[model samples]
Target: MSDYDQSPNYQRGLNLVKEMLGDRFLAGLTASAESGAFAADCASIAIESAFGAVWSRPGLARRDRSLVTLGILIASGKSAELRNHVRAGLNNGLGVEELQEVMIQAFPYCGFPCVAEAIEATIAVLRERGLIDDSTQSAKERGLL
Candidate 1:
Protein backbone atom coordinates (compact mmCIF):
# COMPACT_ATOMS: atom_id res chain seq x y z
CA MET A 1 0.00 0.00 0.00
CA SER A 2 2.97 2.27 0.37
CA ASP A 3 4.98 3.51 -2.57
CA TYR A 4 8.04 2.70 -0.50
CA ASP A 5 7.26 -1.01 -0.64
CA GLN A 6 8.32 -1.14 -4.26
CA SER A 7 11.92 -0.40 -3.37
CA PRO A 8 13.98 -2.72 -1.23
CA ASN A 9 15.97 0.23 -0.01
CA TYR A 10 12.89 2.25 0.73
CA GLN A 11 11.45 -0.63 2.68
CA ARG A 12 14.77 -1.04 4.44
CA GLY A 13 14.96 2.65 5.23
CA LEU A 14 11.36 2.75 6.37
CA ASN A 15 12.06 -0.17 8.64
CA LEU A 16 15.11 1.60 9.95
CA VAL A 17 13.15 4.71 10.72
CA LYS A 18 10.72 2.43 12.48
CA GLU A 19 13.46 0.77 14.44
CA MET A 20 14.88 4.11 15.48
CA LEU A 21 11.56 5.85 15.91
CA GLY A 22 8.32 3.84 15.73
CA ASP A 23 5.67 2.48 13.36
CA ARG A 24 3.11 5.23 13.94
CA PHE A 25 5.46 7.92 12.61
CA LEU A 26 6.66 5.84 9.66
CA ALA A 27 3.04 5.21 8.64
CA GLY A 28 2.52 8.94 8.74
CA LEU A 29 5.47 9.52 6.40
CA THR A 30 4.34 6.82 3.95
CA ALA A 31 0.77 8.09 3.96
CA SER A 32 1.89 11.66 3.40
CA ALA A 33 4.05 10.98 0.31
CA GLU A 34 2.63 11.45 -3.17
CA SER A 35 2.20 9.24 -6.23
CA GLY A 36 4.92 8.81 -8.86
CA ALA A 37 7.13 11.24 -7.00
CA PHE A 38 9.92 8.88 -5.98
CA ALA A 39 11.22 5.94 -7.96
CA ALA A 40 11.99 2.61 -6.35
CA ASP A 41 15.70 3.13 -6.59
CA CYS A 42 15.58 6.63 -5.21
CA ALA A 43 13.25 5.60 -2.46
CA SER A 44 15.51 2.67 -1.68
CA ILE A 45 18.52 4.89 -1.46
CA ALA A 46 16.71 7.50 0.57
CA ILE A 47 15.21 5.04 2.95
CA GLU A 48 17.88 2.37 3.13
CA SER A 49 21.09 4.13 2.20
CA ALA A 50 20.35 7.58 3.50
CA PHE A 51 18.31 7.14 6.62
CA GLY A 52 18.87 3.49 7.45
CA ALA A 53 22.58 3.67 6.90
CA VAL A 54 23.48 7.11 8.14
CA TRP A 55 20.85 8.21 10.63
CA SER A 56 21.26 5.36 13.08
CA ARG A 57 24.98 5.95 13.43
CA PRO A 58 26.66 6.59 16.75
CA GLY A 59 27.00 9.95 18.58
CA LEU A 60 23.35 10.90 18.97
CA ALA A 61 20.48 9.61 20.99
CA ARG A 62 17.18 9.14 19.17
CA ARG A 63 15.53 12.10 20.91
CA ASP A 64 18.29 14.57 20.13
CA ARG A 65 18.73 12.91 16.77
CA SER A 66 15.53 14.02 15.05
CA LEU A 67 16.22 17.55 16.24
CA VAL A 68 19.52 17.65 14.40
CA THR A 69 18.01 16.28 11.21
CA LEU A 70 15.16 18.71 11.56
CA GLY A 71 17.56 21.62 12.01
CA ILE A 72 19.53 20.76 8.91
CA LEU A 73 16.46 20.08 6.83
CA ILE A 74 14.88 23.38 7.81
CA ALA A 75 18.07 25.37 7.48
CA SER A 76 18.53 23.91 4.04
CA GLY A 77 14.97 24.89 3.05
CA LYS A 78 13.85 21.35 2.45
CA SER A 79 10.10 21.83 2.69
CA ALA A 80 9.26 18.31 1.61
CA GLU A 81 11.22 16.94 4.54
CA LEU A 82 9.56 19.19 7.10
CA ARG A 83 6.63 16.84 7.37
CA ASN A 84 8.64 13.80 8.29
CA HIS A 85 10.83 15.44 10.91
CA VAL A 86 8.06 17.57 12.36
CA ARG A 87 6.00 14.48 13.04
CA ALA A 88 9.02 12.56 14.29
CA GLY A 89 10.03 15.44 16.54
CA LEU A 90 6.70 15.50 18.28
CA ASN A 91 6.50 11.75 18.61
CA ASN A 92 10.00 11.81 20.00
CA GLY A 93 9.02 14.38 22.68
CA LEU A 94 9.48 17.73 20.95
CA GLY A 95 6.93 20.34 21.90
CA VAL A 96 5.53 23.04 19.64
CA GLU A 97 7.68 25.69 21.26
CA GLU A 98 10.73 23.58 20.69
CA LEU A 99 9.79 23.32 17.05
CA GLN A 100 9.49 27.09 16.86
CA GLU A 101 12.80 27.51 18.61
CA VAL A 102 14.52 25.26 16.11
CA MET A 103 13.06 27.27 13.26
CA ILE A 104 14.06 30.51 14.88
CA GLN A 105 17.58 29.28 15.46
CA ALA A 106 17.86 28.43 11.80
CA PHE A 107 16.85 31.98 10.90
CA PRO A 108 20.03 33.84 11.95
CA TYR A 109 22.04 31.71 9.56
CA CYS A 110 19.47 30.29 7.15
CA GLY A 111 17.66 33.68 6.63
CA PHE A 112 14.09 34.90 6.76
CA PRO A 113 12.88 33.31 3.54
CA CYS A 114 13.80 29.81 4.60
CA VAL A 115 12.65 30.33 8.16
CA ALA A 116 9.31 31.65 6.98
CA GLU A 117 8.84 28.71 4.66
CA ALA A 118 9.88 26.23 7.30
CA ILE A 119 7.54 27.84 9.79
CA GLU A 120 4.65 27.48 7.38
CA ALA A 121 5.45 23.91 6.49
CA THR A 122 6.30 22.80 10.00
CA ILE A 123 3.18 24.45 11.40
CA ALA A 124 1.04 22.75 8.83
CA VAL A 125 2.64 19.48 9.82
CA LEU A 126 1.96 20.19 13.49
CA ARG A 127 -1.64 21.03 12.71
CA GLU A 128 -2.16 17.94 10.60
CA ARG A 129 -0.79 15.68 13.31
CA GLY A 130 -3.00 17.30 15.96
CA LEU A 131 0.11 18.64 17.63
CA ILE A 132 -1.42 22.10 17.30
CA ASP A 133 -5.05 22.67 18.17
CA ASP A 134 -7.61 25.03 19.67
CA SER A 135 -8.19 22.58 22.47
CA THR A 136 -4.55 22.71 23.33
CA GLN A 137 -4.08 24.47 26.66
CA SER A 138 -1.74 27.39 27.24
CA ALA A 139 2.02 26.84 27.00
CA LYS A 140 2.23 26.88 30.74
CA GLU A 141 -0.53 24.35 31.05
CA ARG A 142 1.12 21.83 28.80
CA GLY A 143 4.56 23.17 29.62
CA LEU A 144 5.36 23.31 25.92
CA LEU A 145 2.47 23.64 23.44
Candidate 2:
Protein backbone atom coordinates (compact mmCIF):
# COMPACT_ATOMS: atom_id res chain seq x y z
CA MET A 1 0.00 0.00 0.00
CA SER A 2 1.12 3.57 -0.65
CA ASP A 3 1.79 5.97 2.22
CA TYR A 4 -1.31 7.85 1.19
CA ASP A 5 -3.41 4.82 1.94
CA GLN A 6 -2.22 5.00 5.56
CA SER A 7 -3.17 8.61 6.21
CA PRO A 8 -6.26 9.31 8.27
CA ASN A 9 -7.23 11.97 5.78
CA TYR A 10 -7.09 9.43 2.96
CA GLN A 11 -9.25 7.04 4.94
CA ARG A 12 -11.71 9.80 5.68
CA GLY A 13 -11.76 10.81 2.03
CA LEU A 14 -12.23 7.24 0.91
CA ASN A 15 -15.18 6.77 3.21
CA LEU A 16 -16.72 10.08 2.21
CA VAL A 17 -16.20 9.38 -1.48
CA LYS A 18 -17.80 5.98 -1.08
CA GLU A 19 -20.73 7.55 0.69
CA MET A 20 -21.01 10.24 -1.95
CA LEU A 21 -20.12 8.44 -5.20
CA GLY A 22 -20.28 4.75 -4.43
CA ASP A 23 -17.73 1.95 -4.85
CA ARG A 24 -17.18 2.08 -8.62
CA PHE A 25 -15.18 5.29 -8.40
CA LEU A 26 -12.90 3.89 -5.73
CA ALA A 27 -12.53 0.74 -7.74
CA GLY A 28 -11.33 2.77 -10.72
CA LEU A 29 -8.83 4.54 -8.48
CA THR A 30 -7.60 1.22 -7.16
CA ALA A 31 -7.30 -0.21 -10.66
CA SER A 32 -5.30 2.78 -11.77
CA ALA A 33 -3.07 2.58 -8.75
CA GLU A 34 -2.52 -1.10 -9.29
CA SER A 35 -1.60 -0.42 -12.89
CA GLY A 36 1.00 2.09 -11.64
CA ALA A 37 -0.52 4.78 -13.82
CA PHE A 38 0.50 8.38 -13.19
CA ALA A 39 -3.15 9.39 -13.05
CA ALA A 40 -3.50 7.23 -9.96
CA ASP A 41 -1.15 9.56 -8.07
CA CYS A 42 -3.22 12.53 -9.12
CA ALA A 43 -6.42 10.75 -8.14
CA SER A 44 -4.89 9.92 -4.77
CA ILE A 45 -4.07 13.57 -4.17
CA ALA A 46 -7.60 14.62 -5.13
CA ILE A 47 -9.12 11.98 -2.91
CA GLU A 48 -6.94 12.96 0.03
CA SER A 49 -7.08 16.70 -0.39
CA ALA A 50 -10.23 17.58 -2.30
CA PHE A 51 -12.45 14.94 -0.82
CA GLY A 52 -10.76 14.47 2.55
CA ALA A 53 -9.71 17.98 3.50
CA VAL A 54 -11.91 20.40 1.58
CA TRP A 55 -15.09 18.36 1.27
CA SER A 56 -14.80 17.21 4.85
CA ARG A 57 -14.84 20.80 6.09
CA PRO A 58 -17.71 22.01 8.28
CA GLY A 59 -18.57 25.42 6.90
CA LEU A 60 -20.52 24.23 3.85
CA ALA A 61 -22.93 21.39 3.61
CA ARG A 62 -22.18 18.77 0.94
CA ARG A 63 -25.20 19.89 -1.05
CA ASP A 64 -23.95 23.47 -1.04
CA ARG A 65 -20.53 22.31 -2.02
CA SER A 66 -22.05 20.28 -4.82
CA LEU A 67 -23.77 23.40 -6.13
CA VAL A 68 -20.57 25.38 -6.02
CA THR A 69 -18.71 22.57 -7.72
CA LEU A 70 -21.29 22.28 -10.49
CA GLY A 71 -20.93 25.98 -11.26
CA ILE A 72 -17.16 25.86 -11.44
CA LEU A 73 -17.13 22.68 -13.45
CA ILE A 74 -19.60 24.16 -15.88
CA ALA A 75 -17.54 27.32 -16.31
CA SER A 76 -14.37 25.35 -16.74
CA GLY A 77 -15.97 22.92 -19.20
CA LYS A 78 -14.96 19.96 -17.10
CA SER A 79 -17.63 17.70 -18.53
CA ALA A 80 -16.31 14.38 -17.22
CA GLU A 81 -15.90 15.61 -13.68
CA LEU A 82 -19.18 17.44 -14.10
CA ARG A 83 -20.87 14.12 -14.83
CA ASN A 84 -19.51 12.63 -11.62
CA HIS A 85 -20.61 15.65 -9.59
CA VAL A 86 -24.04 15.56 -11.16
CA ARG A 87 -24.44 12.12 -9.63
CA ALA A 88 -22.92 13.31 -6.38
CA GLY A 89 -25.24 16.30 -6.31
CA LEU A 90 -28.28 14.08 -6.55
CA ASN A 91 -26.86 11.83 -3.86
CA ASN A 92 -26.33 14.94 -1.73
CA GLY A 93 -30.06 15.71 -1.97
CA LEU A 94 -30.31 18.13 -4.88
CA GLY A 95 -33.67 17.67 -6.55
CA VAL A 96 -34.10 17.52 -10.33
CA GLU A 97 -35.56 21.03 -10.42
CA GLU A 98 -32.78 22.41 -8.26
CA LEU A 99 -30.20 20.81 -10.54
CA GLN A 100 -31.89 22.27 -13.61
CA GLU A 101 -31.95 25.70 -11.96
CA VAL A 102 -28.24 25.49 -11.31
CA MET A 103 -27.61 24.87 -15.02
CA ILE A 104 -29.90 27.78 -15.86
CA GLN A 105 -28.13 30.03 -13.37
CA ALA A 106 -24.81 29.21 -14.99
CA PHE A 107 -26.01 30.09 -18.49
CA PRO A 108 -25.39 33.82 -18.19
CA TYR A 109 -21.97 33.52 -16.62
CA CYS A 110 -20.79 30.44 -18.49
CA GLY A 111 -22.59 31.09 -21.77
CA PHE A 112 -24.98 28.99 -23.83
CA PRO A 113 -22.56 26.35 -25.12
CA CYS A 114 -21.02 25.71 -21.72
CA VAL A 115 -24.36 25.61 -19.98
CA ALA A 116 -25.77 23.47 -22.79
CA GLU A 117 -22.98 20.95 -22.35
CA ALA A 118 -23.58 20.94 -18.61
CA ILE A 119 -27.29 20.48 -19.17
CA GLU A 120 -26.61 17.52 -21.43
CA ALA A 121 -24.36 15.94 -18.82
CA THR A 122 -26.92 16.61 -16.10
CA ILE A 123 -29.66 15.17 -18.28
CA ALA A 124 -27.69 12.01 -18.91
CA VAL A 125 -27.27 11.45 -15.19
CA LEU A 126 -30.91 12.23 -14.52
CA ARG A 127 -31.85 9.72 -17.17
CA GLU A 128 -29.49 7.13 -15.73
CA ARG A 129 -31.16 7.48 -12.33
CA GLY A 130 -34.61 7.31 -13.94
CA LEU A 131 -35.30 10.78 -12.53
CA ILE A 132 -36.38 11.95 -15.97
CA ASP A 133 -38.01 10.13 -18.82
CA ASP A 134 -36.53 9.69 -22.30
CA SER A 135 -39.24 12.04 -23.51
CA THR A 136 -38.50 14.70 -20.93
CA GLN A 137 -39.51 18.13 -22.20
CA SER A 138 -37.04 20.91 -22.83
CA ALA A 139 -37.41 24.18 -20.88
CA LYS A 140 -39.12 26.05 -23.72
CA GLU A 141 -41.25 23.08 -24.50
CA ARG A 142 -42.44 22.71 -20.94
CA GLY A 143 -44.42 25.96 -20.64
CA LEU A 144 -45.75 26.48 -24.15
CA LEU A 145 -49.16 25.21 -25.24
Candidate 3:
Protein backbone atom coordinates (compact mmCIF):
# COMPACT_ATOMS: atom_id res chain seq x y z
CA MET A 1 0.00 0.00 0.00
CA SER A 2 1.07 3.54 -0.62
CA ASP A 3 2.06 5.74 2.28
CA TYR A 4 -0.94 8.02 1.77
CA ASP A 5 -3.37 5.12 1.60
CA GLN A 6 -4.34 5.28 5.24
CA SER A 7 -4.30 9.05 5.62
CA PRO A 8 -7.60 10.35 6.91
CA ASN A 9 -7.77 13.27 4.49
CA TYR A 10 -6.88 11.11 1.52
CA GLN A 11 -9.43 8.47 2.49
CA ARG A 12 -12.11 11.10 2.98
CA GLY A 13 -11.29 12.60 -0.37
CA LEU A 14 -11.32 9.22 -2.03
CA ASN A 15 -14.69 8.40 -0.54
CA LEU A 16 -16.14 11.73 -1.60
CA VAL A 17 -14.77 11.31 -5.12
CA LYS A 18 -16.22 7.83 -5.27
CA GLU A 19 -19.57 9.21 -4.19
CA MET A 20 -19.50 11.87 -6.86
CA LEU A 21 -17.79 10.04 -9.72
CA GLY A 22 -18.20 6.29 -9.06
CA ASP A 23 -15.84 3.35 -8.50
CA ARG A 24 -14.75 2.79 -12.08
CA PHE A 25 -13.47 6.34 -12.60
CA LEU A 26 -11.84 6.46 -9.19
CA ALA A 27 -10.22 3.10 -9.90
CA GLY A 28 -8.75 4.48 -13.09
CA LEU A 29 -7.25 7.35 -11.17
CA THR A 30 -5.95 4.96 -8.55
CA ALA A 31 -4.45 2.76 -11.24
CA SER A 32 -2.71 5.74 -12.75
CA ALA A 33 -1.31 6.63 -9.35
CA GLU A 34 -0.20 3.06 -8.60
CA SER A 35 1.54 2.75 -11.95
CA GLY A 36 3.62 5.86 -11.18
CA ALA A 37 2.65 7.21 -14.57
CA PHE A 38 0.76 9.88 -12.64
CA ALA A 39 2.14 11.04 -9.32
CA ALA A 40 0.12 9.79 -6.37
CA ASP A 41 0.81 12.98 -4.50
CA CYS A 42 -0.97 15.04 -7.15
CA ALA A 43 -3.98 12.73 -7.07
CA SER A 44 -3.99 12.84 -3.29
CA ILE A 45 -3.88 16.61 -3.27
CA ALA A 46 -6.67 16.92 -5.84
CA ILE A 47 -8.87 14.49 -3.98
CA GLU A 48 -8.23 16.08 -0.62
CA SER A 49 -8.44 19.65 -1.77
CA ALA A 50 -11.00 19.57 -4.57
CA PHE A 51 -13.33 16.92 -3.19
CA GLY A 52 -12.84 16.86 0.56
CA ALA A 53 -12.08 20.48 1.23
CA VAL A 54 -13.89 22.39 -1.47
CA TRP A 55 -16.73 20.12 -2.54
CA SER A 56 -17.52 19.15 1.01
CA ARG A 57 -18.06 22.75 1.98
CA PRO A 58 -21.45 24.00 3.14
CA GLY A 59 -23.83 26.60 1.61
CA LEU A 60 -24.00 25.35 -1.98
CA ALA A 61 -25.54 21.97 -2.62
CA ARG A 62 -23.70 19.43 -4.77
CA ARG A 63 -26.10 19.99 -7.67
CA ASP A 64 -25.59 23.73 -7.60
CA ARG A 65 -21.85 23.28 -7.33
CA SER A 66 -21.94 21.05 -10.36
CA LEU A 67 -23.83 23.73 -12.27
CA VAL A 68 -21.24 26.34 -11.40
CA THR A 69 -18.48 23.95 -12.37
CA LEU A 70 -20.13 23.22 -15.68
CA GLY A 71 -20.40 26.90 -16.50
CA ILE A 72 -16.75 27.57 -15.74
CA LEU A 73 -15.58 24.49 -17.59
CA ILE A 74 -17.67 25.51 -20.58
CA ALA A 75 -16.30 29.03 -20.63
CA SER A 76 -12.78 27.73 -20.33
CA GLY A 77 -13.37 25.17 -23.10
CA LYS A 78 -12.30 22.33 -20.82
CA SER A 79 -14.20 19.69 -22.77
CA ALA A 80 -12.73 16.64 -21.02
CA GLU A 81 -13.35 17.99 -17.55
CA LEU A 82 -16.71 19.25 -18.78
CA ARG A 83 -17.65 15.71 -19.81
CA ASN A 84 -16.87 14.44 -16.30
CA HIS A 85 -18.80 17.25 -14.66
CA VAL A 86 -21.76 16.77 -16.98
CA ARG A 87 -22.05 13.23 -15.67
CA ALA A 88 -21.46 14.43 -12.16
CA GLY A 89 -24.12 17.08 -12.59
CA LEU A 90 -26.66 14.55 -13.75
CA ASN A 91 -25.77 12.21 -10.91
CA ASN A 92 -26.25 15.11 -8.52
CA GLY A 93 -29.83 15.54 -9.76
CA LEU A 94 -29.39 18.07 -12.52
CA GLY A 95 -31.73 17.20 -15.36
CA VAL A 96 -31.07 17.51 -19.09
CA GLU A 97 -33.20 20.67 -19.22
CA GLU A 98 -31.29 22.23 -16.35
CA LEU A 99 -27.96 21.50 -18.00
CA GLN A 100 -29.23 22.90 -21.28
CA GLU A 101 -30.29 26.03 -19.47
CA VAL A 102 -26.84 26.29 -17.98
CA MET A 103 -25.32 26.24 -21.43
CA ILE A 104 -27.84 28.77 -22.66
CA GLN A 105 -27.09 31.09 -19.77
CA ALA A 106 -23.40 30.88 -20.52
CA PHE A 107 -23.80 31.64 -24.18
CA PRO A 108 -23.61 35.41 -23.86
CA TYR A 109 -20.71 35.52 -21.47
CA CYS A 110 -18.76 32.61 -22.95
CA GLY A 111 -19.65 33.42 -26.58
CA PHE A 112 -21.33 31.31 -29.20
CA PRO A 113 -18.27 29.23 -30.02
CA CYS A 114 -17.57 28.32 -26.43
CA VAL A 115 -21.18 27.58 -25.64
CA ALA A 116 -21.52 25.59 -28.83
CA GLU A 117 -18.56 23.45 -27.90
CA ALA A 118 -19.95 23.00 -24.44
CA ILE A 119 -23.29 21.96 -25.90
CA GLU A 120 -21.58 19.43 -28.12
CA ALA A 121 -19.83 17.93 -25.15
CA THR A 122 -23.06 17.89 -23.17
CA ILE A 123 -24.92 16.21 -26.04
CA ALA A 124 -22.30 13.53 -26.34
CA VAL A 125 -22.65 12.70 -22.65
CA LEU A 126 -26.45 12.77 -22.81
CA ARG A 127 -26.42 10.50 -25.83
CA GLU A 128 -24.00 8.12 -24.16
CA ARG A 129 -26.38 7.82 -21.23
CA GLY A 130 -29.29 7.31 -23.65
CA LEU A 131 -30.98 10.40 -22.25
CA ILE A 132 -31.35 12.03 -25.64
CA ASP A 133 -32.01 11.19 -29.25
CA ASP A 134 -29.96 12.31 -32.24
CA SER A 135 -32.34 15.10 -33.08
CA THR A 136 -31.27 18.76 -32.99
CA GLN A 137 -34.00 19.57 -30.49
CA SER A 138 -31.55 20.68 -27.82
CA ALA A 139 -29.80 23.05 -30.18
CA LYS A 140 -33.11 24.41 -31.41
CA GLU A 141 -34.30 24.97 -27.90
CA ARG A 142 -31.14 26.88 -27.14
CA GLY A 143 -31.47 28.98 -30.31
CA LEU A 144 -28.31 27.37 -31.68
CA LEU A 145 -29.96 25.38 -34.46
Candidate 1 accuracy as TM-score: 0.68
Predicted model with the maximum TM-score: 2
Task: Please give the RMSD to the true structure for each candidate, in Å.
Answer: 6.7, 3.8, 3.3
Q: How much lDDT does each candidate structure score?
A: 0.70, 0.85, 0.83
lDDT of 1 by residue, 54-125 (tens): 665667776688888888887888877777778777777788888888987898989877777777777677
**Taking the tens digit of each residue's C-alpha lDDT, what string does model 3 give over 1-145?**
5666566766777887788788998998777656766577677677767886788888899999999999999989998889999998988999999998998899889998788878888988898899988675555466774
Better of 1 and 2 by lDDT: 2
- In candidate 1, which residue ranges exceed 4 Å CA deviation? 1-12, 19-38, 134-145
* Model 3: pairs clashing at backbone N, Cα or C within 3 Å: none
Error of 2 at 86 (Å): 0.5
Report the C-alpha lDDT of model 2 over 1-145, residue by residue, as the tens digit. Answer: 5777778888898988998899998788757755668787877877788988999999999999999999999999987889999999989999999998998899889998788778777877888899999797553354431
Clashing pairs in 1: 9-44, 10-44, 13-47
List where candidate 2 sits over 4 angstroms from the true fold.
Answer: 137-145
lDDT of 1 at 78: 88
